[model samples]
Target: MSETKQSGSPELQWVRILDLDELPEGRVQTVTAGTTSLAITHYQGKYTALDNRCPHQGGPLGEGSIENGWLRCPWHGWDFCPHTGKPPGGYDDGVPTFPVETREDGIYVGLEAKPPRIRTVSDVMVETMTQWGVTHVFGMVGHSNLGFADAMREAERAGKLTFIGIRHEGAAAFAASAYAKLTGRPAACFAIAGPGATNLLTGLWDAKVDRAPILALTGQVDTQVLGPGAFQEVDLATAFNGVAEWSQTVLPSSRHAELMSLALKNAMIKRDVAHLILPNEVQEMPAEGKPATTPEGRVTPMEITPPAASVEAMLKLLRTSKRPVIVVGHGARFHMAPIVQLAEQLNAPVVTTFKAKGQISDHHPLGCGVLGRSGTPIASWFMNESDLLLVFGASFSNHTGITPKKPIIQVDYDAMALGKFHKVAVPVWGEIGITANLIRNELGAIDTVDQRPEVRARWAIWREEKLRREKDDRGRGINSASVFAAMNRVIPENAVIAVDVGNNTYSFGRYFECTRQSVLMSGYLGSIGFGYPAAIGAHCAAPDRPTICVSGDGGFGQYLGELTTAVKYGMNITHVLLNNNELGKISKEQRADELEVWQTSLHNPSFARYAENCGALGVEVTEKARLDECLERALAHEGPALVEVRADALLV
Candidate 1:
């Protein structure tokens, strides 16, 4: 294959590939014209193409997929667009983009030379991204990304876009995910080759499960020395395959626009991950084309409508049933007003999963509080006693649904999730928002009954019983309730709380209340080390907001290195270490099985000392009396801070 540079010509040129009908939705195919390899993707009634190699490490871009408008590399999960070759969310470097047009018979990609003096790949990428309305890029600096990082710095100085430096590569990915989720737009992150790419996998997995649109860029070894065991060489494509929706390696400079465009399209449209593997050597290589335009920021319209059969069936059941209960989950979080209205109309008590707490307040007249393993006993008792369960926006997993055999009217966005675990008598398929509206509209059609007075009386008794039970259990060491109450008092209402998994998550669930929807957790992945990185991401996502991370001693240590990232970025996030000094859950399980808890016992460093070593504020609280003062000091500090609270492992 020979490389072609742009000549001073205004005419457009093209390379023809497959027929329009040959492309399939949600899948990609590879095509080669002479020496240039191209990836073609068909998605949401559009077609796009990009180069076959990842810029980071020459990972095959032909294997990537297109969702929305972003093309996701199957290798390391980097994202770029096939139309403009720009990375989504204001990335500096762009992949090569070809002009794609579909005729009655076939699809054609233009091979026009971009303008001269494009300067650097990052400049071209930035120009392309600006066209897409992406204003921010989240990344960490390392040896492999020196040139691109320099370009990003220049871009930031020029006010072309904003670049937020993160301490760790993983933190960068997590921050990008949070930003994308909150804004409903694509976000980008970059990292050096080898270790940096490996470190980012944890955050990438979370994004994949949560369905966030993220573009991950990774530096790669020189393409010339690939697979010959060059320095810092590793198969990044294989490393990221499990988590990314698509992955690709950028090839030689001649094909930059094509590959980059593919990646962006995948990340944006699919609301999934796209990995772009860029070779260290090719980043400075010259390419020519007309200045690429940024994609217009367009909101994806919600198309879900309520199923008539399911809605009618559920309404009939609700009207006839005497003892009905409503169980809300994370799905209901976005439909708070309608959910509350529905609860009021039915005159029924409401219980939420831990993730869905605050969907209704604890003080609501018929609120039963959270319903789960760690939920209020009264809530659980009511769920068990109810004849029909009106499940909304929740999967009714084993963790949330203890009474699966009971008759359930499930409302969900995905119909397949309905009746998968529980006995769902009616399955309503619709967006939670729309379904809530439909239910509200139908409320007036049903016969009216003044059941609120009776329901309120029963709830009062239940609430008192729950308070008594919690009071009796207060003496238990490491009781989650005491920790929650203390935390509730100390943590400010404007704070952003990030919780890790394990018994610590369950414990935190007992007392963590959010006045607003600022709480973040790994509900889908349930990964142990998510808290620390997630906190870093949350802090980066909302710099003005006070962020707090609560993690078990075990979960905290898993991503302890992220503290250094926090320090480096000067993020103001308070990290609360629940120092049980052991893998409490595993230890408890082992003891129950009559096995010795050997490796579960961890020798932890003094957390305060570790935080101090990382150049962050540190405090230790052994007694409950010192907690308030310790937390106040930590929050008052300017940068990242850590507060380690020592507790008995047996309580978990």
Candidate 2:
């Protein structure tokens, strides 16, 4: 029997614990009564309920075995009266009781109403995160991070942030890194103390190497149990030593707001990972009325103009040169407009580093394609012919293969990146857009070579070569040229493409002609399995734009489970999976090194069927003729969709 509160008895709440048939008869089960856990016992064909904890040692009584007409505690084998929860004969200790009733639809448990939420340390830190424009969070919630997860829940409910629960911590980190890469803002990746924290290393390394800002929030064991090798405890600070620019532990004595401020500031200024450790004990501590921190005045404008001396030298070089070329990289993505305008003014052919493939459209009059191993002949021809190279934000990485022999002017915001590998003719320490604008404003019309006609001729020659390659089929698999040709026509102009490493990525660089699209990649790290996870991140960063993932079968297998992540969020991503059934890049490299292609083959499954199983639209294309039609259909679908294009392993 239960009594209803007569309008004043501590405002009550009705909570449905379980469906009527959820629990088997004569079984004891635990249910929540408001925030209090209750031991609901049903034995001898009658329902009885009490505290779920054993009074003796706080062992869970619901988990105890029912033996000889009494419930036996599993921890100490202590017995209690099954019906009234009274102890066996003269023992006063027993579980407390609460009123419960069986409704037609479900079981309901009654207890005092829950109290209003109290501000916690995690709340303060999370509030600081929201205040700093951390809109997207990707990670897995585990045992040690419960208190902090609850705070995130509250924030999500309040519409202050978005939390995506991922299957693997690695995917979470990659998603966060990709978000940062696309938006130039920090996104958080959460994990538990030990293995979870370590799983983030690869993706975090991607962010660190590429100079993208990322935040890591990790949970730890209780403060008291930190030392002496407690479960899930590792030296996280030392573990993240190389990756994070700022790593700190949140303690009860810590100035919660200030801790967050430092972490965020370091992440923004250095474009590095910032980490905060939350001890299990400290995460739930009451905030004591402290306010959260924000990014107001913490960030300064990053538009540094080139020094006058460097500008004059660069102008002199450009003016004297017969052929001038502009080479932009991934770091110049945000400031591409002015760079393109400068190219137009100079009539200079614009060739991009592989990472900066889409910054300059292939359709532009002065735009050449990617330059390097994954590059086109057009870019190579121009770079080889140019007398002066105006490099903006292009890291002199070996992959891009920028020639040090050429007379070059390199511009970057980071002074350390200037002449990082070798001496340049002019190392301008300034923001790329600002420097471009400054040079454009300062320069007068000079007699310089107009490379526009040559640019068009080179593009025409390359397109013919690409078309010829598209038709060279051994009947072993579909050629990559055909695949990209189809995608170039069908995919949206405003699409954000996330490309993975391997032959697929190389082909994308060489064959795909971009027009008004943005490309995201694991640039410096060159990590595989970055495509799909990065798609999730890019979609979150720009929900209005169409998100696409381009990956080979070898790379996609690394994080195939992320398809479910895309499905769960209803991300409108069209994944173009190149299924070659082998690591074609490795095989080709083996051939080049005069070594046997050992262990380069991969066993595969039908990825399209897998996508269908995950509640996404899936289409498999074995015929070269189906590329355009199939991709068009998948891209038209509003949600997550995948098209597995069977390609020849040798064709790429």
Candidate 3:
């Protein structure tokens, strides 16, 4: 019998693979030593360690059964001598064997030390991403994407970026979308080929319709097998057509860093999804000293000022109006400081679209709250009474209910967004902040109604109604009003709140009054499983701020596995889970449509206990009295926590 080199080779380090009698005779088991997977076989009183991969199709030999004194490959049925790591006499291809030693304590195998990483295409591209201010990545590392994932691992080690491994690719995309929505900066969502890449579609569409900047990196099969149908191959370019503003496949001869730079540029400039498909082989190609690029000279300043004619037309309408109201939307979120200043100057009431709920504090004197279906009566009243509507960065979506009857002066950075739905008195095209400042500068004095007293009175009426609803809860569960009331008290004023779809979202829109908290939601898409993952993203975007997730039972169940992710990363997030044990929103919709509410119910476990099982603080609130205490405890937890509120479905 031939044995591995008997003499010591200092380069190969010894690693224990198993203990005595661990593996039964004639059985093969898998083990790892120094990042190398090996098939440890014990047959005929001798143990041998061979490389785990089958030479034919890379099938795992360890998983194969020993039949007739030979190990049969599980995938292809190819046979090799179990003890000698050799195939049939006619075949010359044999599996590489590692030196195995049996000792009194355990069995050990020798492996070479891991080598230093060589710079690859993925490395240069990742470097460019960091240089362009891509600080966070949400992804799942899978077989096809290992090469790129390795590069990301190195970036994480160097502290250039943070990589969050999520339970699903959809969560990764939603997280990236939320991060960009909150920070106005692009964050990347990564996934492997085929199903993993396709899983990101819903969230990518969410980002696309809402005009949020997001970068999507997906793995592809080898370039050689791209045209024909290889395993896990999907034509990513055609698949990402409408969702991604820019999509490209990384090639061996391509300028890898430039592709990354362009992807980011398109995302930033268009406020849309940008995708890159990395072929497995191309990701590991030698960078060959190719330099990474940056946004320093590549990007132009984004402060676009309004045209002279448009500004004049806007001023003419503003100067003559007596009861002017300023409406803002999601696009206006980051530029609210100046917009609020302008609102204060005109003594105009400021209302936001549902997506822009927390752009301006509800406590501000001029802030009138959200508009449309998920809006405050205060906002509706003011908009109905206004003589002129000064809409800034707001798309005239039907959900927003921006009154077309009132003379409208709409301002937007995108020329296409201006007067998109209907003709307005003036559709001023300019960047929101610069335009609002210019309008403030150009208008010396403005005449408008002082709507503060009306705003205060409306808020008082709503609060009274909320208190009444909170008290009249049936014997089913605690009212959502009480839950949000507790949140208004316990949630940090400067927190970032990610809300999910369904009745919980409507309740949040109606009941949760923002002080300084930033609210994130699946706005245009209204996706249900967005809350917890978005909270994860918001935390990544602003780690210093308190992060919270508000979700209903049905919505929370969609991505409950992400709780482990939050726990693993020690994300300081307080999840307010409203558990009604049903898809309350769908039930309500069915009833509203005069149809029987079927298939809207859900089976749920003890979510609080589940959180605890996932290594997080868990508190369940069954009674109204316990609501405040439970929320306070969860909010005060040092790490990921869940407060499950057994909420009444009808109360929302």
Candidate 4:
């Protein structure tokens, strides 16, 4: 705040507004003195000041035209006296007036000392999000969410959070979902009202169905215009009804940080989408110095032991079966070592669902590769010969059919996921790692049959079949099998691979044998543009891990702009682009269903050249002979790189 001061008059507290020469005579302009905005008018060789806002809809009086000595509001044509801020009519209320004076160097406005900025609701909530370990946010900042974005900006400046501005809201959501999938923790996505908010649906559904925890922060129109259709307004809570496990709108009356606490807790405990909508005005409302919330005592330990009866049932099934096998899904990824120990105790073959493709190495003595539609003959043969299925954290999706007739003992952390589609002989609802240990403890040395020889025999048969097909190139382009063979040879043992949905993905699932790599995919949602964006998240989650992304011509085209983002961040991603110049999966489905494959073919640019234009290493592989050299170069590159392999669409 400042006070008016003149050379010949008593001095009061005064703050500089603008240089006297800056405002011409007979003109009015808006200026700021700390938090107070003023309309400084220069008329009659003197200066006067008034509040800049008009009472009529809060329009800027300074922007109004001075006609007939009256300042007319530009928004609605309301009038006020230019010097006195008095309306032309007998209106009781007008803009407030402030004292002003001229100094040698500048014009000064009279007020008290400038006040410190008030803490805001968004500030409290962003601190709470930080305390909950949500360090990364992916989204675009927009007008509706400017206040919330400002809070994030402050936190980012303070090094408490990192915000990645994205080209699309949908990509933000996918990146957040993939972050959660990779780290088993919550990351946030942000958007403005209407279309920006709605763009997050597909990725939200991806996290929801796959049981990944994610937070969505959306901006809404002012509460007053919510129902009357303000410019970008939409009922965000209603729009997110089924997708988010919990959703709420922030209000001035609400506990600001508590709302954020609940959103984070719900996402963490439920392992699903949690959302918060910040109304425009409410987001900027003063928090009055309220403290933030945290997860200090909010979360509980997740691991639990199975019931005694279920454990006994599992033991009995394991002891009696001549051929028992263990099957894990994406849900079991974090607890692989314990399950592998249990597999060794029973000499059982371990197979994975496609989503869990690289949980265990294919070279492991007991590892029988993936089991399902995108599976190998080794897994199918082992499953057919098994008498009991020791299922762990696997959802029996139709794509990965766990035979109903087999005697089964299913284990999972979520009670709802235990034999969700059908009944099992033993449904053990316990944490995966704990239950695996319990099974191993009870069956100390159960003289189980050694199935290692059979596993080796099956692997030989599958490998022989794969080799026979690898040479079946039709001369159109490189064969799918050959490309994957090159990948299996080039990618590191500890690489993280994100595969998109298409014929290329199917080939990856079928032919790319894992040594110790981890695979991430869209899984239940099976969205197309997931690979490249997910690779970004994976790189962020484990910066030291070699990250690889595989996508088809159609899938990569969807989020093609993300390549620049990879380059901007210098993410170490070796993107394997299999270009067949068509949506081969859809074409195959149409042909199999007795329909003409219409609109499935596509037009594509040279993705390798595109990557080069984006400042990344790019290699084009048209022949099988060039694949190894190209892949080696790409994987060894320091920053982001791409290997575009032209392939035969029909071979997949």
Candidate 3 per-residue lDDT over residues 157-269, each given as its tens digit: 99999999999999999999999999999999999999999999999998999899999999999999888899999989999998999999998989899999999999999
Question: Best lDDT goes to which candidate?
Answer: 3
| lDDT tens readout by residue for model 2, 259-279 | 988898899889999999999
Q: After best superposition, candidate 2 residue 434: deviation in angstroms?
A: 1.1
The C-alpha lDDT values of all candidates are 0.73, 0.89, 0.92, 0.89
Count steric clashes of candidate 2.
3
lDDT of 1 by residue, 1-652 (tens): 2122243335756667987677777777888865468777676677766666777866676787766767778888888775555678787656664557787778876665445534567556655654565566777777777666766676778787777776667777776776665555677888989988887887777777766778888899878888988878889999988878889887664455545566777777676898888788666665455355444444356658876887788778877766677898865666777877877777667888876766676657767777887566657877776777888877566677547667888888766767776466888888777887787787565544444565566556754653453353333244544466567777877677888887777766654544553667776667787788778767756778899898988888877887887888788989888887788888877888999877987889999999999999999876666777888899899999998887666554
Between candidates 2 and 4, which one is better according to TM-score? Answer: 2
What is the C-alpha lDDT profile of model 4 across 1-652, one tens digit per residue?
A: 1222333334445779988699887778888787688888887787888888888677877776777777788889987876677786677567777777788999887765556657899999999999999999999899889999999999999999988888888888898988899899999999999999999999899999999999999999999888988898888989999999999999989988899999999999999999999999998898886999989888899888888888887888788887899999989999999999989888999999998998999999999999988988889888889989999888899998778989888999999988789889999989999988878887877776799999999888888888888898888888888899888888899898999999999899899999989888999999999998899888888889999999998988998888888898889999999898899999999999999999998999999999999999989999899999999999889999999999999997
Report the Cα lDDT for residue 351, model 3: 95
What's model 2's TM-score?
A: 0.94
Give the range where candidate 2 is weakest over 10 consecutive residues by summed lDDT.
1-10
Error of 2 at 31 (Å): 2.6
Summing lDDT over every window of 10 consecutive residues in candidate 4, give the lowest-scoring window.
1-10
